[model samples]
Structure formats: structure tokens, C-alpha cells
Target: MLTRISSVDHLEVKQVVFSSVLQLGDSCILNGFSRALAVQRETEIFYGDEGNFPSYRIFKKPLPLPPITESISFLRHNINPIIKVNNIDVTAVSNSSILHVGNSQTVSMEVRVKHIRQLLLEGHEQDI
Candidate 1:
């Protein structure tokens, strides 16, 4: 499993009210990238709710089965998320970028995570 953190700034808005609360949707499918993390296993995504940050719900679903392949399948991809504040769609200026806190404005954050196995043990030649 892998995790990362990134930030963004320099945002412009005319009129937008932020969400005061976050409620998880009953059934919501994660986006392509977030869903990809659930390959063959269920996963939960948590975002924002950091120090003085409002929590946001991404999605709720079971793990998706990855494509069957005889050879080893390598996973390599970066997730670029589009952030939304209080039902306001914030255009992603760049990949994995968030809007900059403007004057007298606030921002909320969110994250997603999925893990299959907790522990795995492999034996090698001359090495247990």
C-alpha cells in the first residue's frame, strides 16, 4: 500500500458557502482513481477533518476485482482529485492541487484509502 500528501493555493471565488458538516452517503462509488485502490478488496476513504478542517465523504463501496492475468500485474498510477467545497465545484487547476484559501474564506479537505491484507509473509532461499 502507498500514500501521499499534496497541497494547492491561489483560488478565486465570487460567492460560495462552505459546508458546516459532512455526512457519508449511503452508496457512493469512488472515482476511477480512488476505486482503483480497492482492487480485489474493500476500502474506506477519509479526507479533510484535519486540524480545524471539515470532513468530506468520497465514496462507500466494496472492493472491486482486478483484471485476471496469468503474468504479474504491476500497479503504477497517480491519483489526481478534484476538490469540492459546500457543493461548490472547484476546478482543479493542476493535478492533485487544492484551491488556495482566499481572504475571509475557508477550505475543506478529504482523503481515500484501501487495504486488502494486513500482514503477508514470504520465504526466500536461505532466508526465512
Candidate 2:
């Protein structure tokens, strides 16, 4: 496989987090795993959300079957030996994600999110 780019004018990436990858060229393999625990409360009170919490701790355990363990075989035929791009004006890539401009053999990505939202009304003081 071949990749060619004449011009890349601008590329803006605001944020990338939690085992993320941003590739501009060819790659054999790309693997990413992200786990997050989010808590949102209406009031200013904090619930002490931390890694020690049971929900957050669950991600620490190993996966049942990881992608790397599996055997993979593939054959690629490159009829066109060259890939030409005249111009790339603007690009934005964000978050546990991949942006590849060229050929890729294998790409694997996994994301797990647990979000908890709590609302406290003005007249619900007794509920607490």
C-alpha cells in the first residue's frame, strides 16, 4: 500500500484521552481501550466519585478475551500503488478515536461508560 499527500493545510485536535490513537499514515495494527465512570449532580454537593468506587473499580479487571490474543490473517492487494491527495483543508479529531489517512491492516477499539445523574429538587429535602 502507498499513501501520498500534497498538502495538509490545518489539523486541529482539541482533546484526546484514555488510550487513544491518532495516526496520520499507514499502520499495521491499532488497538484502543477506554473505560470511564461519570457522575453528575444537579446541586453543588459532591458525591465523592473516585477510582475506589465499586463502579469505577470494575474496569480494573481483565477482559474475558483480548483482541491481541486472537490470531488474525489477511491479504491486501494494492492495485493502485499510490494514493494522492491534493489538499486537506481542515480536520478535527477528538476523543478515544482514530483518524488514519492511509492504509490499515487491522483496527480495534472498545469503550465502556457508566454515567450516574442525580437531581435534587428544592422541595425534596426530606427524601435525603
Best by TM-score: 2
In model 2, the runs with Cα more than 4 Å from the true position are 1-18, 53-79, 89-91, 125-128
Q: How many residue pairs of model 1 clash at the backbone?
A: 6
Cα RMSD for predicted model 1 = 21.3
**TM-score of every candidate:** 0.20, 0.59
Residue-level lDDT of model 2, residues 1-128, one tens digit each, is: 34544233455665555566666767778887666767777666765645444556466666576456768899878675655555544344444677666678877777777777878878987766
- Indicate the TM-score of model 2: 0.59
Candidate 2 lDDT at 26 equals 76
1-128, model 1: which lDDT tens digit per residue?
23233223333434323322222212122222222132231223333332221222334543465676788868667564322334334433322223332221223333344433422234432332
The per-residue C-alpha lDDT of model 1 at residue 19 equals 22
User: What value does the lDDT take at residue 24 in candidate 1?
Assistant: 27
